[model samples]
Target: MQPYKKLFTYWFAVIIYDLTVDFTKSYIKSFKLKEQMDGAARSGKQNIVEGSEGMQTSLKSAIKLTGVAKASFEELIGDLEDYLRQNNLKQFPKNNPKIEIFRQKAAVLIKKLSDFYKNESLVRNLSNLSYLEKYFNTSSVEEKVNLLLTLCHQETFLLNKQVLSLEEKHKTEGGLTEKLYKARVQHRGY
Candidate 1:
């Protein structure tokens, strides 16, 4: 599929990966923590691609891998939340004015992502992921993590939608085994 023609999971995972890298390099100093964050980022992105490719042969496998991607983001969210709390920073509520600002930026970032495939520069396209980096420049690390948490939650919610869609498709169209059974029946004239 062109530019990952599915839901936004892989694209959002790319954002998570870049944001985590920026956060790790700029704020966090622990190598172990960086490893965990980066691992989750990769898993979150890769699983979406893997699951999409598997859909041709196996819907069950695709649903399972999509769930894995969701799990990875959930892990990433926990890590971000822990970092915020342990650093003695305040976590913002959903109704916080600051969150609305960050949420709007996330919407802009998603629009930028749609233009990414046409961009010739890989570096430039990846730079789009760092749209939130400007806020991290002057803001407290706590604020930055809160913004990340907000974006992560949105992406996770959409992943849930993707999983549900896949499950419904499977229920309606069946899977490889069902196809094989039907083909066998047709050949046998049953």
Candidate 2:
């Protein structure tokens, strides 16, 4: 099984975490909300990593963990939405030009990071957070919240797709335990 670390979603989670940290530090004054937001962001990212690492041994576990990651991102979406509502900020609509542009840039950056990791030996170690950090730092609070919400939505969508695929594969092929049992039987000439 390919490591989850290789997935673009994993790096997206990292970027999400970085942006959340910056958002909370610069904009959120309530310590409790800040901690809760940060925790959710971290959980979203970490669960994906855990899910990927367990994929080889247990598809069921991976599916569950990935679901957890999706839930965490959903929680973040709520937080970002709440922040915008409470502050009387307008969220970017689905058809907004800025939303489309940001989505495109995010996709490009994720692909770049994926390629970098795929060829880590040839490329110098680099962080993709810089690209977003620049925008995050300069954007208004409303824009920041909107961008984060979009990211959360994207992450949850990806996670859901991943879970469905894993479930399908599990149904058709079974897990490591089944494979091991089959190998054992064959080895014993059953």
Candidate 3:
């Protein structure tokens, strides 16, 4: 499959998993947390799409971007687990049965791409792009570039969105109130 397409599929799986969690919730206790998760999920998919588009022009840039995407998803997963535990939700089902199907599919695709890139030629060329080279060993230029781009976009998008949503929620929840109050107190004291 085209590298971009595979990346997109992986990202889409993440989104679906998030949606499942969101919909199954019996309570709406933490809107902010929910929003963050949703945003992270969207970001994962969006990044993949963006990276794929970027690859059409700059392979190197695309690879870097895909790296960002991969990081984002990994972060989101960590966040999800934390949130679940903090909220006293039951342990994520064995292998996360709820999202296992999608997770498995994404894992397989990522492994396949990783294996394909473990060729000697691609590895030598990628060495110059050190950050991206770690993703593959060696493969054709097109394959290596595409895979890197896909991963970057997916992960970055997820991380960025989750962070943004969290920030927004904090702002809405009086997190900035202390700063504002301090400023007012300083002005009065002056």
RMSD of each: 2.5, 2.8, 17.1
Q: After superposition, how far is residue 7 of candidate 1 from its true place, in Å?
A: 2.5
Backbone clashes, each candidate: 0, 0, 17
Model 1 scores a TM of 0.87
Instruction: Give the per-residue lDDT of model 2 (tens digit) for 36-70.
Output: 99999999999999999888689999999999999
What is the descending lDDT order?
2, 1, 3
Q: Which sequence of candidate numbers ranks them by TM-score, best first?
A: 2, 1, 3
Better lDDT candidate (2, 3): 2
Per-residue lDDT tens digits for candidate 3, residues 1-190, read 4465444344344434333243324333577766665565566566666766765554444455555655656655665455455655543333434334434444554455445544547434433444233323324333332332333334455445644554454456434345578789999996
lDDT of 2 at 34: 98
User: Quick one: best TM-score, which candidate?
Assistant: 2
Which candidate leads in lDDT? Answer: 2
Candidate 1 on 120-140: residue-level lDDT in tens? 564365666453466434266
Global Cα lDDT for candidate 2: 0.82
Candidate 3 whole-model C-alpha lDDT, 0 to 1: 0.47
- Worst lDDT 10-window in candidate 3: 141-150
